[model samples]
Target chain A: MSDNLPASLPGQSDRVVQVDKLSKKYGDNVAVNDISFNLTKGEVFAFLGPNGAGKTTTVEILECLRNPTGGRARVLGYDVSKRSDQAQIRKRIGVLPQDFNAIDRLTVRENINYFGAMFKHQLDADKLIELVDLKDKRDEQFKKLSGGLKQRVGLAVSLVNDPDVVFLDEPTTGLDPRARRDVWGVIERLKSQGKTVFLTTHYMDEAEYLADIVSIIDHGQIIASGTPDQLIDTHGGKKTLIIRDAGEEGLKQLPQGLPKAELRNAGDIAIPLHNGELTNILMSLAQTPLHDKEIEVRRPTLDDVFLNLTGRRVSEEGN
Target chain B: MRSRIYTIISGHFKSWYRSKSSIFWTIAFPLLLIVLFGAIFGSGSTKFDLYLQNQDLSANTPTYFSQGYITVLNNTGAFNLHVVPAEQPDPLTYVKNDAQLHNRGQRLLVIPLGFNATVMSGKNATIQLYMDQSDQASASLAGIVHSVTVSYAAAIAKAPNHLILQQVGIVTKNIRYIDFFIPGVIGMTLLTTGVFGAVNTNGSYRELKIIKKLATTPLSKIEWILGMVGYQMILATISLVVILFFGYAIFGVTATIDIYTVGLVVAASLLFPGIGMVLANFVKEAESADAAANAITFPMMFLGGTFWPRETLPDIMKIIANFMPLTYVNDGLRYALIYAEPAQALTNTLIALGLASFFIVLGSVLMNWKEE
Candidate 1:
């Protein structure tokens, strides 16, 4: 309900889920190759990666859906490899797979209630329906819902047990902008409730807005891991000042006080800066080439951080 | 984990039940087929229409024999008999009319002039029997009736004066239409329940990626299999009750050993659906599963003696039926129905059960929870 979360509580555990050297191979192609990470309690951890980068494999293993070929994982301090401990771990975790499918024939309420019955500590049926904002369509068939509603229902299903950790693999994929924002609202609520949310996404803005700690995985290995701000401050690139002017002559004849910039277009120049001197740059641009023109100053984002670390833009690297 | 298994199973069952179209297609359609087939084929049905042209019906005619010969020939039991007196005089014209009726599949018996004189003279008299051979059963029945007539004529010739002939032998087997039909219905019921029920459901779930979600859950392969088997067992039980009642009400197919017969049918029903699971697992997709199931079921429905006697089929087809599992189920159901001998049915049933278990195990092996 609140935008700002409370301070970290005292006497909380550092790790809620731990994976050590997990690897899974399908004949020739390796899905997860000797990768490991730990998720602390009440943290919104983002698994940032391009498609086929083993983010899903790691999430699946942590959810106990997959048995790792060569590593160990524990959830809520229970060994996933042990049969007796798997049920205990699964009881504490919830998984929202990439496809986000429910039985097409059942009504929405039945779908939620069915999964709710899986765990001992499940949410009330009405409460879960309200949580997902699907109460209005509770009696509708599962297949009749739109994609966004289906995604919301999936999140509701994940929360059915009031789980310690919720695993969402590309939760906002295939959704329109509005639907993505709606899902973002749901995730924010989950974080406020102090539920650990482990999710994977290619959307830089999504990770920037929701993740407390972002881990960028590539080829089954975590290439970068830190808080979003820390990663941008350290490995990420400089903030940029984009200026659109009347002509190239005015841009090239910029004053000496302005910083060095890249020519983005004939009438536009982008100035990169490590320090926050956007006001000074704007003041200088007012008197010179960018006078009576459009100018924008922005901070470094997850895309910039990825570009700095990988030497290619996130979108370009995805392909 | 136990709770999760229960939840998943109940979830699947509830979801399937909620789909009205699927329930109709899966459960109701077969019942409709039983009613249709039973109604059309159940009663003591007649297969042909017969016509008789008697030129010498009057006892005063020289050809007329004792009154007993006329009594037997004039009797029409299971045929539609139309008698036209021969007073029109042109018997050849009468033969033409008779032939027309015969061409339309009517059994026509033409008693020519001097037919009674020949019989009274102790000579072998011939009553020309004509029928359309296009209808095979009617043609066969005509042959049998003709032979019976000739035997009657011979008996009359042997004791012309003592016209009341005795020393007759009649043998009848007391088997009803239900006796033949109930077993076939059971076989068809099991075939549909096994093939369409399991295969179509399995394939569609795979296509929808529903299985992938379940795989991610803490549910084990065995648990999933048990859940499915449990769902089908419930469906099959309901179907058995409705079908058995239908059999008795419409065809008088009494489940005489109502309890043991039920127990056997239920066991067989459960056993057969295992084959469906096997097909579902092996085929991998809905279209392929449907195709494979039809390929197996349609032939067996016809060739395995579910509808007709396997003996009527070519020897090669009968040999083919030997390999089919439904053949055993059908025969075993019949044996159980008539004699209430569960033990007599056991040997065939064990074979079916063994095959069902094989399919179940094979289905499990083929079902990869984590498919690409």
Candidate 2:
């Protein structure tokens, strides 16, 4: 949102990050198995996985902060394995790691300014502070800041180079609800500026909201990858129909093509929508339900999609 | 390249200077020791007790030779004579009793029999001096007495007399404790600011994930480390000048301020930042890094030549002191400051340069920006 982040140069490459069959292992333990992904310009790709699921390892490889054990990864069209290319990639890419921090002894402005000096070309530090909504805190020492403010500084530091691709690993893990929303706002702004954002988070709702493309990993392998609606449509459970206070005659009047109806504990007869029959069954229910009865149709959510894909809640799988 | 390094150097400097604790540790701490010790011992004449026994059987009353020698001794500003009554113990017995009690600074002077007659007759006279050998306090006092006696005898005889002592001195001036102490202070300040600053700050940056973040930048670890060393040297150079100036201002202590002394300190400073980086590789957390650094530095502080010369140490400790790096730092600065011989400090400077190279390379090996 700041002019300091020069308009994404018109000649920038389309694929900001690309990975194919990347893997990482710590001695006998395989941290990341072969995985492949790619990012086009101005897209927010959310990489979600359980703990030890290799999401971080994948991101770290793309950020050039780790050496992949097998296969190849490139950032800004440069092969990450080449030492010469690493410098060039680092110059063009920004990374905000899990538990990232700015120098606590330095003020916010100084922290950003120091990081800005690390690159050949940099955004204006004062403008970055203002962009991150830290104008009043520009001169305040980082140690005295709250967690949310510190993360804001980390965000500003990540943007110092006006990077082509930004890696935000678990950017909002420990934030409160309000701070989480504030950071989400910043990510939204980054996307608006045509910056390719590679994000890894456990918050399915976050992935659902901010991600244009989503990839789910488990046990060092990607279990599913697609747009949020596509993943939900593919891996999600059947839609549920709940009809309350329906008389026996109304139940008898229901469409026969619907799957066997069962009475739920909440005094509602719940019916599952069989494949390709949700629309017809819902229409039949609309015709049968009395005026006083309550009726509801619940579609599958991202959390359900994650559970259906991984067989465990995202929070439970990660922890 | 210069811009990247300057960024890191300026960033480090701003962080270090703004902290009150760092300013105290780097500048105030050393200056306090130098000024306090210099004031305490730099501006005074040493005082020792002397008891005189008259055994001049050849003289009837107080003779000129005996009275004149006593007056000379008193005027030398070195002796505080104890007025004893006639019933007091003999000078030797009094000195022995003082020694047995472990008291310090008591000495005895005995004027020989026929003292005035023998001296007036132009014949050599021998005066006996007694002191506590184990106490280590009588060396200066005994020197003063012997010189006064021999000179007075020469005046009476109209010729010089033969007298021998371990050290040759005219006793016109006493060397101040500060003059002997300023070099040690400089050595210590450089050691602390260099080693502790490097170890603690680098280790803390690692612990806090600052280093990991910096790794994402285009700057390499070598550049990062060199930048830190450059910054510390600037701080150390400024501190060296200011502390030496305060030494001269607060007390009349003078140190040789030549290019060689500056080189010794600068070369010495370049070694520790690398050492700190090496130390950080082994220390995991900020708090533990401080403990580990103190564990290494505290013993070196007392055992190295900073507090006392290595020659005074026991044979085994001397061998250990030779291995401790700060000993060379102390010795190098001591040579430059006192003897004005940078050539003599050559061996130490080379070793410091070697260590600077070794640890910096080793630090780069241990510091992997990619490793979690």
Candidate 3:
């Protein structure tokens, strides 16, 4: 894999982050196993996992917030485990924590300007605020803003240094749909500007849309890592039968010995379609009650790949 | 790094000053307390007024017990004696009339006709006293009269060669309570700003992940501490001025607001944040930090001679008072202001500075941002 990676890439080939057999343990509890991966320069790498799947622990280890129990991890060519390299590493990378907030009394502009002062090189604060679409709210105190606006301010502060690499941990968690889209726009701009982004998310659609590479981690291990299309092609089947708004009684009207599908919530059944049986299944279900409802045949998504690899189910919430 | 420190200090000040409620709490609250306590306790001198009626003057013996008691009470300058007139008759009428005219601690002392005869013969003698039980000042007047009579009786019972205990007035300064209380109120205000303000700032930042954001930057822990303590010092200085100005203007406090008093405030500003940080190190959340600050400061507010004097505390509490940093703050400021004792002020300053250094070092060592 390493030989192919080096040869297939044209001229630019450099690893921005390298982790070799890294592990972190709290007494007897191992939060991160001996997992290893490398992030190339100028790539958006997504670490996908459930609540305690060691995604944040690994990010903290790379951000130099925690110490590793064994093996090595480096950021921007400096060892993260060494205390001497911290000042250097911090100057080059920006981190947005899970519970991040600013001084509630300061104006939004003031908060961004305050963070800019902590670095040797910084972006123009007004321009940065405008980039996050907060120019009109620059004068308002942080506490006066809504939760969504506060997240936008948090993102602006994270980019205050114009860092080479930015770490966003669950950046869009607990946000409304519109605010989530706002953050996704900001993330896209960060990548298009050639900044390497390391992100972790519980939303499978987020990583599927924004990530160049995705790793599915579960119980302190990475079970799969690839492009979204590649992973879906490998682990997920070709097509799925999506049935919506059909009642339980309606679903029971289908003929026996027909191509069956997995039952989803609210009278919906989505399953991998069997090969060469789609015509036969439709003919058998023509007289059934399910034919009156909405149905679709589509390709497998990264969500299906994720469910297949980690055994974490997709509920009605749609990830 | 210097820019970062300046940014933090200025930002802290901006946040604190923008809110009208903060100004009222940090500046106005202490001023209110100083005016209330200093005005109530400050104006009057500690002198009790006594109207003495000598019924035994005509039946007096070789050793006049009334004369001896009167001599002791007047010699210490602790009592103002007004002889009850013969034409006026009742001592109680004289005292009641005096109380109606002046709301002072006025008392009536009547000597029985055979009082001196019984005392010379070594028999028990009774003296009558008229007091105003409703008045706070009159509550202590009876105790003073009793103590003085006990001393006079001891002098008469023992021989001429026996123990002759004399009360001397060495303090000489007719210092009112406002003069004594102004410095203590200033000390209290400093403690409030330095400990509670700084500790809450540290704890909330840690709780909100603001510290984590800074920790990820190039900001070191030392820079963070210095920026916070420096801001607190500024706040303490501002509080000192408000309390003292009201003390002098309204309550007639006489302490010269000089450089040494300012130095005491500055030292406190530098000192108490370390104490606050030490307490903050033991807690993980902001609410617990507030409770911890209260746990440390509420006892100190009473025992450090803030509203009450240290001399008034019990023996055990007085011993505990000696160990608090605010005690030294109160001591140094009092000595500088009320007693005009430079040597004592210097001694207190040294102890406070030494303790401040210890707490700052211990707190810095224990300020761990990483959670398990």
DockQ of every candidate structure = 0.35, 0.54, 0.71
Pairs of colliding residues, candidate 2: A51-A318
Compared with the real two-chain complex, what DockQ does model 1 have?
0.35
Determine the C-alpha RMSD for candidate 1 after optimal superposition of all C-alphas: 10.3
Which portions of model 1 miss their true places by more than 4 Å?
A: A1-13, A243-271, A274-293, A311-319, B1-9, B39-179, B206-210, B215-218, B249-253, B257-260, B263-269, B338-344, B369-372
Give me the candidate number with maximum lDDT.
Answer: 3
Q: B86-153 in candidate 3: lDDT tens per residue?
A: 44555564554343223334557776676667776766777777655654555577667767676676
Winner on TM-score (1 vs 3): 3
Question: Would you give me the overall lDDT of model 1?
Answer: 0.70
Measured with C-alpha atoms, the lDDT of residue A161 in candidate 2 is: 94
lDDT of 2 by residue, A35-142 (tens): 887777889999987677888888888777789999777787788888888878888888898888788788999899888899888999988887789999999999
Best candidate, DockQ-wise? Answer: 3
lDDT of 3: 0.77
Which order, best to worst by DockQ? 3, 2, 1
lDDT of 2 at A306: 81
Candidate 2 residue-wise lDDT, B173-278, digit = tens: 2223454466777777777777788787777777667887888888888788778878878887887788778878877656787665766666666766666667
Which 10 consecutive residues of model 2 chain A have the lowest summed lDDT? A1-10
Give one digit per residue, the lDDT tens place, for model 3 in A211-274.
Answer: 9998878778877888888888898766977777665665677678866666676777764578
> Per-model C-alpha lDDT, please?
0.70, 0.74, 0.77
Candidate 1 local lDDT, A1-319, one digit each (tens) = 1111222222244577777777888888888877677778899999998888888888877776677888777777776777787777766788888876777878888888776765567788889888778879999988999999999988888888888889998999888899999999999989988989998998888999999988888777777888899988888677787777545676576777677776754666778865667777777777774577777776888888877777766563344
In order of appearance, the predictions have TM-scores of: 0.75, 0.76, 0.83
